[model samples]
Target: MIGKVPKPGKSFGGCIEYNVLKKDAAVLYADGVRIDKVAHTIDDFNMQRKMNPSLGQAVGHIALSWSPNDKGKLDDEKMVEIAKEYLQKMKIQDTQVLMVRHKDKEHPHLHIVYNRVNNQGKTITDKFQHYNNLKFSKQLTLKYGMYMAKGKEQVNRPQLKGIDKLKYELHDTIKAAIKKVNNITELKKELAKQGIDTYFKFRSGTSEIQGISFGKGKYKFKGSEIDRSLSYSKITQAIQQNVQQRESEQVQHKQFVSDLKAAVQSQTSAFPQRQSTGGKSLLEVLLTPEYIEPMPYIYDTDERKKKRKKAKSDL
Candidate 1:
């Protein structure tokens, strides 16, 4: 097992985040902590109360992940023991440590949570401390001789049988088609030509995200499911970027319309009018209140009034 420990630093919004990354080579057992429970406790004591739930700071979070080769051979009890070892190595003595095994994915991992400041009032300083955790984890791996992930070969050759190769190639072909096409119509045609049929669906109260599944020569992809850059930062960043670009274009179009209207209003003139007799307003005679009751009258010149009077008589 290998580990990478990074120093605690300010997060995107200026709040400090203390995190630890551990490669879980030992597949004993796995568990998880309820983040709300942990966050509530941490927030109640470590921060001033606030109405915003996400406003609280993250005291500390530790993630232990490992690639799994055997799904059924995990030791649950040993997994908790290993978690305790990590806490001991981190020198967290008096804090409540929660350990959980997450089985959502193929691999098993342990997520641990502990207070940075111990009950004894001792603060754990960030002193290249992650190195210690990694060192201990490596030592444990060596002691147990757990299944370690092999490093990438220099020649970049994959080890797969003939049937496996065909399955993998088909998977890649479908994946490539999905990436190239924009809308569903084009994607379906492309997949059909490649002897693959796809289905799309959506779920509510979940991620509001989309996903794809391939099985038995059938391909299914949700237009919104696959993330373009999963290897990058949080998924929210990508979503936010797409939304901002759309909003920016909308704002530019609105501004263009506004400028065009302003230009026309500033440069254009109204229709020319004839003078009125008796020094009355030309609009008043043209639109007399008596003729269009309850509306303001438009008095016009004698010539213009004569034309309107003639038109009313014809009507």
Candidate 2:
């Protein structure tokens, strides 16, 4: 299941009509208003909004969509129960709301319209509502055992309209480009090939890049707006880690080459030189160790024998 919470608008009648009067649409449930007619419902919502005239754009809208695989699992009553539970979890109490189920697509989905101006004339807080919407959607999907989408990869990009399409386009382009580049500069250059312009948001009076935004045509979005993983800090960390890994490999390769060269030089220096001695090469002398006579063996053996005999005779 997925939830999209668009920014509230100022038209209650138009929103209600679009949800209720659209083709194949049915109002499953409505609270805090008369449901016999759309005008009466709009009038009742606006009557409360009149109490807080200072607030503009007093409409809150949420769309809940289930995967087509879970179509048969949900019925009108169960869906209404889930919607009411969702609204309660979202802290949208004391507000006029209408839930309409639409059969315009293959999936089971519903649209929620509520008055941001509650019955007590207090403005319902919308701060971090987008983030909250995502959180509550996942929670309810899991609690209800609905099909969970795998991520943006399974999204039907062609079916998305307006900013949603642009967001996915940027996400796909930037994510693919990040894998092939080495740094932010190369990243920007690569994205530019796809007509995406990268702009850095720098801190005041400093050179630090505090954020990043991507623009294609007239639409521009902060990196975090597209997806959390595409944020400037996350991208920078991934790039730096990649760079360090490459540098480490290069250093290891250079060290291996230096060690091999040193080993070759040492082997060449340790090799024995062949020198000619008295017209005989050192190799020949070494090979003929037995043939070379010592100084004592060079003397006459006869003279030594005669001297040994004389000594024996005297004895």
Highest TM-score against the true fold, candidate: 2
37-99: candidate 1 lDDT, tens digit per residue = 434434433532122234333244566655475244446776576667766776765654445
- Steric clashes per prediction: 20, 0
Report the lDDT tens digits of candidate 2 across residue range 14-38.
8998998999999999889999988
Residue 27 local lDDT, model 2: 91
Cα lDDT for residue 78, candidate 2: 90
- Taken over the whole model, the C-alpha lDDT of each candidate is 0.48, 0.86
Please report, as a residue range, the 10-residue window in candidate 1 with the lowest summed lDDT. 12-21
lDDT of 1 at 308: 91
lDDT of 2 at 134: 71
Model 2: how far is 206 from its true place, Å? Answer: 10
List the candidate 2 regions with Cα displacement exceeding 4 Å.
192-225, 231-315
